[model samples]
Target: MAVGGLDLAKYCSSYDFNSNDVKSCSRAVDLTEACNWQKQRDDLEGVYKSADLHSGICLDPKGKDVGGIDDMLGFCRQKFKRTLDVRASDADGKDWRCVMDIDKDVVCIWQYSDKSLTAVQENGLWVCRRPADAASP
Candidate 1:
C-alpha cells in the first residue's frame, strides 16, 4: 500500500529487506490500508486526529533501526496497531508528532510538517529526516 507518497512494500524491497520480513510488513501495511494509511491532513478529524484515542502495537526484531522504510516495514509486519498520540519533537524543536506505532519500544512514525520531514522515532531518537526545509508546522 502507498501513503505519504511511498509504496510501503516497494520501498522496503528497494532497501533489500528480508523477504520474510518484507512479506510481514506488507501484511501489516495491508491492514493499515484496510483502515487507510496515514496522510498529513490539515483537518483534525477522526480518532487518529487525537492521540488520546489511539493505542499501540508490538514491534518485531526487538531493536531494529526503524529509521528507513525497510525497518518500518519490518516493524509493522509484526503487529498492526493504531498510532499513539505521543508528543514528539526533533533536534531543532520541530513538532514531530508520533503518527504511527510501528512497534513497541521499536520505532514510531513521526510527521514534522513545520520542518517538512517525516522522521522515525527509535527508542526516543528521530531518524530518517526527509522533505527537508519547511516553512511551517
Candidate 2:
C-alpha cells in the first residue's frame, strides 16, 4: 500500500507497543533513533527548512490515532528511560521520536544515507522526494 506516494511495504514497518512482540517494539525504537540522528545532522548543516522538521515524525496506520508527535515522543522517552535508567541523562538529552497519522493504515519509518532524498510536508502530510523533484514548481 502507498500513502503520499510512498510505497509503505517497501520502506516501512509497523509496531504495537502494547503487543507482546518485543522485537518489533525494539525495531521501532531503533528506527526512531536513526531518524532523530538524521534530523540533527540536517539541522546542524541548515539543510532543510524548519517546516520540514515535522517529517521526522514516524508514520502510523490510519485510524490508529496514536496521538500526536508529543505523545509518541513521550512513549519513546519512557521506553528509553526504562532501559537507560543509569544514563537517564542521555535518554532525555536526545530528542524523542514521534508519529504522524496518514491515509490508510500503514507505518513507515526509514533511514536514508542518500542526501538526495528529502522529506517535505505538504497539505499537512509528509512526502518524500528527490532533490530535483522537490525543486520543481
Candidate 3:
C-alpha cells in the first residue's frame, strides 16, 4: 500500500519484527517521509494563535487533538533550546495553563488577531513580541 507518497512494499523489507533492527527499520520508514517534515512544521506554525486566556502566551489554535502545540514545542525545543508558555481556555472561559521553563533569552512572543497570526524573528527567535495593545492578564 502507498501512504504519504511512500510505497510500503519497497520500504518495508522482510525483517524479524521482534529483532533489535525493528527500530532501525522503523527509522528507515520515517526517514523516507522526512522531506515533508519542514513543510508540515511551517504549516502548523501558520495556524498558531495566542491563547485566549493569556495575554503573552500562544498555542496551537486547533488544540491537542491536532497535536499542533506539541509538535511546535518539540521543534522549538530541538532547534532553539527555548520553550513556549502555552495556555488554553475552556468553553466556559476558565483558563488552563501549561508552562515550560522558558529560556531567559526568549525575547519575542506570538501576536495573533482575529484574522491573522504573526511570528517575528529576533535574535534567532521566531515568535512575536506581545502586542502592545493586549490587556494585561
Candidate 4:
C-alpha cells in the first residue's frame, strides 16, 4: 500500500505500524508525519504533489480514508510506539534528550548529567520544571 505516492510497501504491506514496512522504511519518511494529520497536512501535501498524486487528504498506508485529523492522530498513536530519538546539549553544558512521539511531536527537555529534567518545552518556550508542554510554537 502506498500513501500519497510513498511506496509504503517498503515500510509495510498494511497501514499498521506493526508491519514489516515500519522496520523497512521508517527512515525514509517520518512515520510520525505520515501518520499525523493536523500537524503534517501541508508537508504531506508537498509529498503528494511531488509524486504527481492528489488525494486532497492524506491517506493511511492501506488507502483507507483517515476520517479526520483527530482520528488519524489517534489511529497512529494506537498503532505505533515512540519511534524517534534525538539528542543535544544546551549552552550551559546540560544535556538534552529529545524523544519524537508517534505523532512526530518532539518532547525535548534539558537534563542534568545524570539525566534529570532541568527544563522542558512549555508553550513553545523552554522553561524549568514546567508541566503540560505544548507543541513546538
Candidate 5:
C-alpha cells in the first residue's frame, strides 16, 4: 500500500505491526481488502513526525511513541559515528525539522516549499541547512 508517497517497505514486510493486518485475503475473506494497515502506517509516520516536531529542542529522546531532534542527531552521530560526517546535520536551533518521510526517505530542514531535501532510502544521504526562518521557535 502507498500513502503520502511512501511505499512503506519495512512496514509492509511484517504483519506483526502495531495495528496493521497484512492479510491479502485472497481465497476467502471479506469482500474488500482493507483494514488497519493503513492506520498503523499513519501512526508510525506520526511518531517520526513528532520527533521532527521537537527536533533541536529536547536533548533526550521523546516519548516511546515520539522523539525529539537531538535523538535523531545522536543516532547519526553515535550509531553511525564512523559515517557521521556523511550523514545529515542541523544547527542548534528551532524551526529545523528532520523526519523519516513517508517513503522512509530522510527529510531534513529545508525550505517551506513542498520540495524539501529528501534522500533516497537505498542510496545517498540527506543533509540540509536551517531554513531562513527556521532559526528559532
Candidate 6:
C-alpha cells in the first residue's frame, strides 16, 4: 500500500484499473509492504541478538548476492542455519554489518571495519550487501 504509492480508492477514481481488480492489487501491495517490513525487522533483530553474528556474514534468505531471488532463497537453509525476514534490494559485490533498532526496523549499515557504508540507493530503495563468502578470507 505505502510502497506501491497507489491506493484503491484513488486508483478506482481513475479509469485505468477496474475497481474490483484494484482491490487485489492494493491488497497485494499491503501484504508486500507488511512482509518486507516484517522480514527486515526480524533479520536485523536476529543479528543484534547474537554476540557471535559480527565475526562473519549472516547469509539470509532474502539477501543472497547471486542467482535469481527464488533460487537464492532455496540455498539459504543449506548454507546458513537460520532464516531471518528481510526486504529485498538488488546489488552484488559489497559487504556490510549493521546496527539495528529492534523496535523500529531501522538499520545502520557498516563495513567490516565498523566504518559506515555509502548507501547506494536507487530511487527510494536501500539494500544491504555482504562480502562474498569466498572473498572474506
Candidate whose lDDT is highest: 2
C-alpha RMSD between model 2 and the true structure: 18.9
- lDDT tens per residue, model 3, 56-135: 22223354223223243333233323323322223234332222322221212111222222344455434444445655
Tens digits of per-residue lDDT for model 6, 73-124? 3232222223233222122212121111121112212112212322333465
Candidate 1 minimal-lDDT segment of 10 residues: 99-108
How does model 6 score by TM-score?
A: 0.15
Q: Rank the candidates by TM-score, best first.
A: 2, 5, 4, 3, 1, 6
lDDT measured at residue 41 in model 2 versus the true structure, 0 to 100: 27
Q: What is the lDDT of residue 45 in candidate 3?
A: 24
| Best candidate according to TM-score | 2
Higher-lDDT candidate among 4 and 6? 4
Off by over 4 Å in 6: 1-70, 86-89, 92-137
Off by over 4 Å in 3: 1-45, 48-67, 81-137
Q: Which portions of model 4 show Cα errors greater than 4 Å? A: 1-71, 78-110, 113-137
Q: What local lDDT score does residue 87 receive in model 4, on the 0 to 100 scale?
A: 18
Q: Looking at model 6, which ten-residue stretch has the lowest summed lDDT?
A: 96-105
Cα lDDT for residue 82, candidate 4: 41
What TM-score do all the candidates reach, one by one? 0.17, 0.22, 0.17, 0.18, 0.19, 0.15
Give me the displacement of residue 28 in model 1, in angstroms. 17
lDDT by residue for model 4 (1-137), tens: 10012233322322333222211322123333543545444333212313322222455556655433334334344334443332111222221112121211111121211122233344554333323343222
Off by over 4 Å in 2: 1-114, 133-137
What lDDT does the true structure give each of the candidates? 0.28, 0.34, 0.27, 0.30, 0.27, 0.26
Which ranges in model 5 have alpha carbons more than 4 Å from their true place? 1-69, 89-137
The local lDDT score (0 to 100) that residue 11 gets in candidate 3 is 22
lDDT string for model 5 (1-137, tens) is 11133323434323211221222101111101111122222222222243443422221223333322333443333333333232223333332212221223332222222343342323333233333443332
* Pairs of residues clashing in candidate 5: 55-69
Better of 2 and 3 by TM-score: 2
